[model samples]
Target: MSEREMETTDDDRGMDQLHVAGVTLTGVARGGVETCLMAKELGVMFDIGMCPPGAQRYGTVLASHAHADHLGGVHYLASLRSMFGQKPLKLHVPVEAAEPLQRIFAAWSELEGYQVPVEIFGHAPGATVTIRRDVQATCFRTVHRVPSLAWVVERVSRRLKPEFQGREGAELKRLRQAGVEITDEHRAPELCVTGDTQIEFLLSDESAMARRARVLVHEVTSWEAGDAGAIARTRRWGHTHIDELIAAAERFEGEALVLVHRSMRHSRKAAEAVVARMPPSLREKVHLLGN
Candidate 1:
């Protein structure tokens, strides 16, 4: 297809080839442009900047805030699912943006002449919802111009209680047969995706989810070196500068960091060049998601 025709197509917009944290992660993100990510394994997507006609495959989507770049495709996704007769889609949005989003959906539903099968949920920081069996999601505050939120997906499982660790199989069976509480709940931070936030969100103790996550997806809109003034603009826009991440490298404990939401002004080469200069300790764990 021609370039213009390609852009108008219902394709995933080049999001199909991505893989992250053992899941199919697809989508795009650039400052003031589209931004979205889908974790196929969890059947959940983060944001809805650009929706493919087939987004009904994503059973649940979490919107960080109401920014156009973050929620531009929400209506399309919901309408497509309803039109195609797919299972109901769940949209979890920040409490502040919930009403506005519902109104938008209501308008579309009226125009389409059919009730959209989308359920809107409002969540504030500290609210936890079970996404699936053994998987749960929690939101945390993110410092952005709008009321944004960062999400953490945790894996919850049951492990033998410390007191029962050394128990014999027969004893364990007996305890279980006796209805004893031989297992303890264990939760591990599996993934964290922050849409648009200042560096403070990553550096603060409140971001415990990011610190403990096995994989973290964060925004690094600008990495121009020696541009102190430019760095200031990043903070002013509620985005993080790469230098801040470098400065607080030791504080991050995630196994891998997926750096995304790059500014369109920076070419892929420019972004890679900056990554190349990162400290070896930090470089090895960074995955630059070029726009």
Candidate 2:
């Protein structure tokens, strides 16, 4: 083996073996650029108008924004509770969308004769909500034709270090005696789904789209533009450009970058052509989905 191969440390070696499996994201920008995901074990769905096959069973739904593609499927999820005789589905919405939706839920609730819960959680920018212990979600403010949100799903775990691998008893005693920063860790950033935002949001170092994720799903609509009015409209309407996405992934070393939400103007071939221009850093980690 080469010297470089010999020098790889155990942590690096074990990193490949880490159990990082997680939620299933599908129908994301697949048709109509709708982002629908199934938090498989968490038993919830995030966004669902362009619902994927077999996602009907998930009893909960979340609307990231007021877009028709993102939220048009909530009516279906609500129907499932009555159809399947399952419990009422939880629909989480941003504060702005929550009230108007609550009225709709009220009417639906009356029709269904049972209340469907509208869960308003982490609707505010930078607010965090724990959907469950292993799953926590946070929303970020984004620019869009309507008020929109970007989200991050974080996975948490606890493990003893190699040095303290077998020191459970004595280390536990000492830790009790001393106030150490003993806590679980983020196994990896599970997923970051950017609904729709302008180029500056992805490029901004301070934005939530920064370094805190493992898989990043961002929109790449209008990728062919030379960044003329496109950039201006992105600023005006709150959308992101592909170039800014490249820069963000490069800046933060995102493990996987999934570009989505291709506009109708860009054909599959056109999208691929634009993606071909990505720098190695961007090309290495970035992926174009549903092109």
Q: Can you write out model 1's per-residue Cα lDDT over 1-291, one digit (the tens) per residue?
A: 124323332545546445656745666777778788877666578998877543546768877888998888888887776665566778898999989877887888799887777898999898887888888999999999999999999888999988889879999999899999899889998888988998888888899777888888888888787688998999999898888777876677877888888888888788889889988998888887645
TM-score of each: 0.90, 0.77
Q: What are the RMSD figures for all models against the true structure?
A: 5.2, 10.2
Residues 1-291, candidate 2: write the lDDT tens digits.
224323323121111111123444544564355667655555456687554554556655655687778887676666654465555566767778888877777888899787765454437777776666777777777667777777777776776545555667877669857976555474555777777677656656556444557776677665754777776655565666656666556655557777777777778788777778877767767666554
Q: Show model 1 residue runs off by greater than 4 Å.
A: 1-13, 16-24, 166-170
Clashes of each: 0, 7
User: How well does model 1 score by local distance difference test?
Assistant: 0.81
The deviation in Å at residue 67 for candidate 2 is 1.6
The collision pairs in model 2 are: 143-238, 197-239, 197-240, 198-238, 198-239, 198-240, 199-240
